[model samples]
Target: MGPDLWNANYDELLEIPLPKQVQLTGFADDVAATIVADSAEETELLVWSTIDTVEDWLEQHRLKLAKQKTEMVVLTRQKRFPKPFKVDIGETTLTSTRALRYLGVMIDDKLSFREHLESACIRASKTVSSLSRFLTNTIGPRTKKRRVLLEVVHSILLYGAEIWADILKQKTYRRKMAAVQRRGALRVTCAYRTVSEAPVLVIAGAAPIDLLAFERAKLYNAKMNGDNSNEARARLKKETLCEWQNRWTSGEAGRWTERLIPDISVWLSRKHGETDFYLNQLLTGHDQFNAYLFKMSLHPTPTCKYCPDKIDDAEHTFFECDRWKDYRSSTEEIIGARLSPRAW
Candidate 1:
């Protein structure tokens, strides 16, 4: 706009001397100020036009650079060497056939370079896609190795003929582990525990064991001979069991348990006539736990699914809407007659 405005009025505006005339009222200081203002405006107009031209040239330069970079490999191979012939320079002589051979090799290499570029681009795309998927999983240091191992184990279970996979799947193995030191055999399998903790190891005497397996076997032998009978081992075993118990118990110890129970009641009442009991069970879980910040009474006000206006709280969602009232009315009808808004 700056340069364009200048273009429309440049010569005409400069010839007027409006700023100079406005200041020069027969006083010396006024005449000086008028000249300064006029000069400043003319300088600004010129600067704007120069900047516009520079920007256009820069854009063209970038396009040229991009095209040159894209075709660099092929261009580089088409060499024009300056091999000037001279008397007594050396015993070596340049032959036409030798030069032609070099050119032929260069041409062949250029063709191969194009194919390699395409292959490189494909590999780069695959790498980028893999990285994107990995990033999207949001896996951190703690979860990354565990997730990878889990995936490997799952793949072996589904596709490989690994004996550990079979053992891991057995109900007997789990039952045995659960009963170890209690009653029956432990139902644990290699998949559930590291080889060191697993009590059972099946081996064909002739087969070579992996390094990890060998180390595990050595540890097991040591344990059997009471090499780890010290208090430290006992403490570690106790702590492991305590950790397991805490993980199990705390899962059901959510702070909002009391609030969820009543919401489940309301959800069951609302959904009872529309769906079967099993479906109601699922929806009740959804309504209770999916409550706004785990509080059922305050329904989460969604952002206007249609527009950008943010609904503040549950009451706004239920009653006020600059535009969503009509849709909300139809949704309200879906709830059973017995479950009024107050009950909800």
Candidate 2:
């Protein structure tokens, strides 16, 4: 049947008065009824009576309730469990479940939403792994790969973020979501897996995943309050970037990267260039630089191989080394300014 027909059916269902203490809500053909009472027996009695009223209504409309697709769940926060009960409508018995998938979000007995977040992470991880098989650090189009990660994979992970985004405030949940983003960042930057999360994210020009989720939640709230969508999004983008910059600056990791990219906003605002393998290496300081290799225990010393006196890191290679002077001068001439650690 069409949506208008279903809407009319639901509108008619709303006119049928349910038992006392019971409330009924229908969306399309799915009906959810709730009863709040002091005891299980009273709740069950009210539920049965409510079901009888619903069944009678359905019979008049010649619609049979799908017994196999029906589910019931009891939500409680008590330390001791409530007594078990079966809800029988016609010949079907509905057993209470600890959790149920309503719409798309998973609702648990305790309403913690742990199950839904875990499932989202799993799904995002799988999508990243599958994409990784086809795309590589140097082989694929960097922009498209990043687009897929942000558009496809992120959509999967943040399906119902507006509702559950608050859970990401917990360190455990934040870390789980960050791990998935880390994988995508690795692909985007084409950097080594050894690169830490903050630097990889910066080099990849991706905001922190938790920050993105929080932005989504805030934007949703703003829209509900009658704010303009585009204006709200722009304002939230600035706020999110500020938070990301604060975290990056205050954190202990990615110190070298911080020097190269002091302002994340400038880095992200670049419209033309993509972060290719070489550029990612330069920004993250995770390339074959002697200093990084030495830190990784793959080289004997941190001295530059060409200069043999200065430490060879991203800063030295990009700004100090004489070997790349011509390339640096050419870039400086193109940009009409000299390159310095603080220039960006």
The number of the candidate with the highest TM-score is 2
Q: How would you encode candidate 1's per-residue C-alpha lDDT over 135-188 as one tens digit per residue?
A: 332232222233343333222212211112233234543333222211100011
Task: Write the residue-wise lDDT of candidate 2 on 127-152 in tens digits.
Answer: 98988886787787766456666567
Q: Backbone collision count in every prediction?
A: 10, 0
Off by over 4 Å in 1: 1-311, 332-341
Model 2, which residues run further than 4 Å from truth?
Answer: 83-85, 333-336
Q: Candidate 1, 167: how far from true, in Å?
A: 32
In model 1, what lDDT does residue 73 have? 15
Angstrom error at residue 120, model 2: 0.4
Q: Per-residue error at 189 for model 1, in Å?
A: 30
Global lDDT scores for all candidate models: 0.30, 0.83
Best by lDDT: 2
